[model samples]
Target chain A: MSINKDTVKYTAALGRIELSEKEIEHFTGQLDKILDYVHKLKKVDVSKLAPTSHVLEMKNVYRDDKVKPSLPVDEVMKNAPARERNLFKVGKIIE
Target chain B: MELNRLSAHELMGLLDKGDISHVDICNSIIDSIDKKDKSLNAIVNFDKGKVLERANAQKGLPVFIKDNICVKDELTTCSSNILKGFRPPYNATVIEKLLNRNAILMGKTNMDEFAFGSSTETSCYGTTKNPWDLERIPGGSSGGSAACVAADEAIWALGSDTGGSVRQPAGLCGVVGLKPTYGRVSRYGLIAFASSLDQIGTLTKDTEDAAILLKIISGHDPMDSTSVDRPVPDYAKLIKKDIKGLKLGIPKEYFIEGMDKEVKQSVLDAIKKLESLGAACENISLPHTEYAVAVYYLVATAEASSNLARFDGVQYGLRSSQAKGVIDMHKKTRGEGFGDEAKRRIILGAFALSSGYYDAYYLRALKVRTLIKKDFEDAFKKYDAIITPTSPTPAFKIGEKTEDPLTMYLCDIFTISANLAGIPGVSMPCGFTKSNLPVGLQILGKAFDEETILRIAYNYEQGTEWSKRKPGI
Candidate 1:
């Protein structure tokens, strides 16, 4: 139930965030305190209760599969850090 | 004429009477923001020329938008370094509605990065000072919206509430903050924080202004599936209904130990005021209240981890120059881009939702969330509304709780449950502490029942003089 610096680092890596050793140690201590506080939920017996992921009772929202006007290529690419004519450019994905 | 200090409805009256033009009101607020914002730092992105241009083109009251909400081609950085220069290509549903009503688009205000912190200090741009006392914090992540309204820099503003983001800050800054029912407003163009808990709300000079602004923005949109296809009420008119014979619940769990004595007394006084106005009050219990903060952090951060995954260096925002590969690019970009609190939440969230731990953390928290929602549902069946303090204390000093993240997380103790239950809540200036900082009284209503809370807030606001006072900036 306790987290160490390695676990913190591993979790950060899984979340796609690279943390320094200092950050890993810092988060290890902080997350322990937070998770300790959260451990109080273990006492509440919720065995028969259903988990409420969302408050509203929503059904599958179906929309007509019509061809809708989309954002222009230039406007969508405007915020891209690196881009080609119509596609976002990124670092090489494969060797 | 000090038009900046006037509420939106008051300005509307003047504009209708030919006593003032939209340009005149815009100029007044622009002047006030120019003079006061340097000291307060409430507004992060403001252009007088753009505001006046909107005023000239659209004859409506100028409303400042929190930076998280997109405004079409305007820089919509959520007070974070990662989103520097990132402008959304379209307007939020609320923005579209406001524009359709001829409302002038005031500039963007500051907030916690990705709406992550309870205090505005976590913002990458710099902290927004509480107008009441510059040394103290403005309750956030809607701190800038509340501060601007309190200081007359904005007539009204749009702020998204995840936990107590909108209401707590409004209470701290001596303004009115109203968070409608979760599905009441569309979240189409709002930058995602926690998808389920996020609800766009208002910070305004008074309850009437809150109601008016809420009316303009509250409606279902085809873009947001979660938004209910229900008819939007005319809240401005509905709020005027008398609270006679209305039943109010006073939840004892909220008045816990370590709470500020003045805040408790102010809320107690507000209850007395409600009783005197013919609304009956009775003690009630929301037993699951103690676990709300724990449940919220789990649910909110878990969703945040997923929502924020989109910030990788591919499509938008800051991309690191030194990244060697795609995976390395995402890691380096997020590592360098996000602030400390954001990283903390993201890591904590990933740990909770990681395999083997998911059932113990996220799933258990969701079950507890149901109990919390039932607490209100059970209360609302007997009482028309539930009342409590918006925050446990008046605005704390800037650096007071910054060192202890747990202490800062506990600051939203009283306000987080409303979001957990997906109910409507409002924080209005009920009284002030001895040092003159504002104390907010919160009223919680049933799901999709913003009218009851807004009605109670409206009547209480009308019977009180606290909303009349302004920060002496």
Candidate 2:
């Protein structure tokens, strides 16, 4: 239940966030402490309880398939870091 | 009298009587911001010209918005470098509602980066200093909103609370803060922190203003499917109703060892004040309260890690220039963009939801979350509301608990349970400590029952002069 440096590095990778050596070391300690604290949840007998992913019991909210005016193309792309015409530009995906 | 110092309700009275124009209010606020914000760092983005222009057109009250809430074409950064210059293409539902009512969009306030921290120190714009004592923090992620309101730099503000982001800051700043019922306010455009837990709340000079702002923002919106399709109450009207004969539950778990003595005394005094005003109070148990922080961190961070995945260099927001591949781009951009606390949370969340740990951490937290919600349900079956201190202590020194994340997390021990339960809660000033820092008294109500908590807060506010005492910064 304790976090180690390898766990920190692996988790950071999964989250797509790069971590420095210092950050990994720092987080290893902090996350270990936090995980150790949260380990208290193991004491509760929640065997019969359902997990509450959401507070409200909502069903799949469907909407009519209708065409509606949306934000202008320029407005949508206004904040894009790199764009060409109406398309978002990104780093090459394939070799 | 300075128009900025008056409550929104008071300003509305002046505006109605033709004694003060909206422009006058804007100018007065401009003066206040000019005078106080230098020391406070409460407001992150403000253009006096834009505020005055918006005021010239709108006849409604001026309302400050938290930086996290998107205002179309405005710099809605969430106080993070990742969102630097990333203006939203559309307005949040609450922002639209305010504009539709002709309310002036005053400016954006500072916050904990992506509403991630207890203190406002994590913000890219720099920490917002507490008005009571500049050396201390303005309890945060909604610190800017609370600080501005307390210092009168803002008439009122909107802040999103996942785990006391609104009420805690409001408490520390000596302003009234109310977190509406989960589905009460539309979250259509609020930058997602934790989808299940995040609820937009109000920070204002008084409970009446909180009630007024909540009324304008609460209600169903087709854009947010989670918004309850129920009629919004006339909170201003409901707030006037007395809390006579109302039964209040005070959970013993909230008053624990190592809590500030002054804070405990203040909350107890508030309970007595409520009793003297005809509301019956007694001790109640919410045994699962001890597990709220654990559950909240797991649930909130899991959602945040997922929600924040959208910022991965493909679309808007900060993208790294030094990357060879798209995957590398994401890692580099985020590593450089996020602050220390944010990185810690993102990694912890990823670890919890990872293959081997999901059951023990994230899933178990969710199961415990059910118990937490059940505790409130059990309490509400008998009591009209639950009362507790908003925070374990008043504002602490700016760097007091920064180095230790656990101690900082403990700061929210009293406020996190309300979010876990999806109930409405409000924090209002009840008394001040020996050092003159304000102590907040929180009132928790049943689901979709904002009216009750606001009513109790209003009544409590009426019995005390705490809300009237502004910080002399």
lDDT of each: 0.92, 0.92
- Each candidate structure's TM-score, on Cα atoms with residue i matched to residue i, is 0.99, 0.99
Candidate 1 colliding pairs, count:
0
Model 2 / residue B435 / CA error / Å: 0.8
> Which residue pairs in candidate 2 collide?
none
lDDT of 1 at B181: 94
Superpose all Cα atoms of candidate 2 onto the true structure and report the RMSD in Å to 1 decimal.
Answer: 0.9
After superposing candidate 2, which stretches have Cα over 4 Å from the reference? none
In candidate 1, position B397 carries an lDDT of 93
Model 2 docking grade: high
DockQ of 1: 0.91
